[model samples]
Target: MAYYTSNAEHPIDIVNIASLENRVKARMDRGAFGYIREGAEDEWTLRENTRAFNDLRIAPRVLQGIDHVDLSTSIFGIDLKTPIIEAPSAAHGLAHVKGEVDTAIGAAKAGTLFAMSTYGSTPVEEAAAAAPEAPQFFQLYMSKDDGFNEFLIKKAVKAGVKAIIMTVDSTLGGYREEDIVSHFQFPLPMPNLAAYSASDGVGKGISEIYAAAKQDFVPSDIAKVKDMSGLPVFVKGIQSPEDAIVAIQAGADGIWVSNHGGRQLDGGPASISVLPAIAKAVNHQVPVIFDSGVRRGQHVFKALASGADLVAIGRPVIYGLNLGGAEGVKSVFDHLNMELSITMQLAGTKTIEEIKKTTLL
Candidate 1:
């Protein structure tokens, strides 16, 4: 049997999106993937990420008519059918052969946004083409070299990306203990742009090129990218109010509060715990996004009430891909939308705007 198919009698039954997590866990050994980070020493932040959401309770409203719901919302002027975006992670090829391409198709099918990572298995152009009509954001990793960074930004602009997400947390790799202990290999190899440049008689090393690209990067680099590509720009991995302030000042169109899934820093507060403060700091200048450990519809509601303009999911989609490829990804989003609809109906929210902080206790 194939790893993913629509057949009903497969060894792994994937009726629900959440079920795929267990199935993937059962089938794959822990050591197969990298980026899990290291030790319980830093896991405090990881635990807090989910626990912070749990600390809050929702105050459901009854007797309010909500037979219909509108989940649509706009991010950076592009309307998304839902308030969810696919959080970028490295190397989808490990989960399935179609890799990021399949993931993009799935996100489009679900009527959501897709964010492609710097280290995605497929090239950015290919992924973008796979989901032409879907809103797409290119996640950028600051290279040690500025020139290389410029190359990527320019290329992404030409590729029709709707936004550039500067990931600020991963200046260096995280201490994911699971990835370390398992010796998990990344599914894709690093881009060989430098090698190609060298072949063309450019003497710059990859790091040097990357540094040059970022050499002139200032607060306005956000504006420059937006002007160059006519796309919105966002800064991700923001943890502090001060940093959030800097991002907004730097011409960032949005702020994404993330601890890099607790993969970057182990002792940081859960992204959700700090989201309200971050949102407050932005003071409604721009939308604040939340991610880290969102696993349920209640978590989504809590994030929305806490002030997240949108929420992103990482591990859950990967789990789905591992279990059933494109169908698995579609199933996960369907389940989430269904759950969100039910939660909204129960909470008496007929539109996303109607879901307010008061909905949660």
Candidate 2:
């Protein structure tokens, strides 16, 4: 069952992402809020994702003859007006009415990429239709049922998804005590599974896929997606340099450095902490996507300077959805775009390429 919650009693007065987050808290009940806010087990890695950013300070350059900053960039041939992309998050029903579809449309209006989660409440086809022109990626969960996984990919292709991000972490569900204590059951009527006409034999829904996938999931499976689907494929959940190497060797087109937002494993190294080595390991062979605990605009700047080709946001996007659906998300993106532009201007970096490790202290 899906935990569909209610919105706040009043309209949100957005000042920053934090304010949006507070609104989410005010709107959602204990279970709904805890589901998004809590991390796996003790949440050691969860806290670290943010603390790692605080540990680094930016060394700003002044009087370098930069009048304006341009945040335009591209990944996998998709042009982005800003360096930020909405990271994939599933079950938007807990946040808002429309769920992933709202975020997808908001991303289109904001001129950025949106990766629809495999567990999204809205079907990929319907969500893709929400923003027909936006560059969208289908985040894949390598189902125990190989054919079911392929069926999901085929749906993405038919829906004009730009790429496929196979999540390497989260093979098994996290030990989120928050959900257990709150008794938060997932909402019913999953559009993705409901729409999935997998006649090839299945139990019920995604649980079976996860059950079949406890030990057998591997990067070679990601390689197969690249080879067979012919789509630009990336491996998400690369936390270490060795993992990045393995992913590249397995023929991944890109590496997404994340700790599943510190939701999959507790007591793991922060996402940002492991990014520099992973970025260096890949050595520009493929785009390095970064995520986990990206809230403020300066956080986005930090990720770019550290080595992220593009920064994907998760919680903030969820907050925006809960705050005001598409409009809320647009506001979040706009604020991020402005923050990054200001950071570039203040730091004396005029373009995305100008953002490098040298930009940091």
- Provide the overall lDDT of each model, using Cα atoms, as 2-decimal numbers: 0.72, 0.81
Candidate 2: list runs displaced more than 4 Å: 1-13, 197-209, 212-214
Question: How well is each residue in 233-308 modelled by candidate 1, as lDDT tens digits?
Answer: 7888898898899889878888988988877678778888888888889988998888988877778878888888
- The estimated TM-scores of all candidates read 0.86, 0.92
lDDT of 2 by residue, 1-361 (tens): 2345544222334667766666678768677688788899999888889888998888878979999988899987789999899998877767887888788988898899989887777889989999999999999877666676777789888999989998878778778888778766564455665566433222233344356553566767877788657798989988999988988888889999999888888888899898888888999999999999887888888999899999999988888878777877887899888888888888888999988645466
lDDT against true structure, model 2: 0.81
Off by over 4 Å in 1: 1-19, 34-42, 191-230, 357-359
Against the true structure, candidate 2 reaches a TM-score of 0.92
Candidate 2 at residue 264, lDDT? 88
lDDT of 1: 0.72
Model 1 vs truth, CA RMSD: 4.9
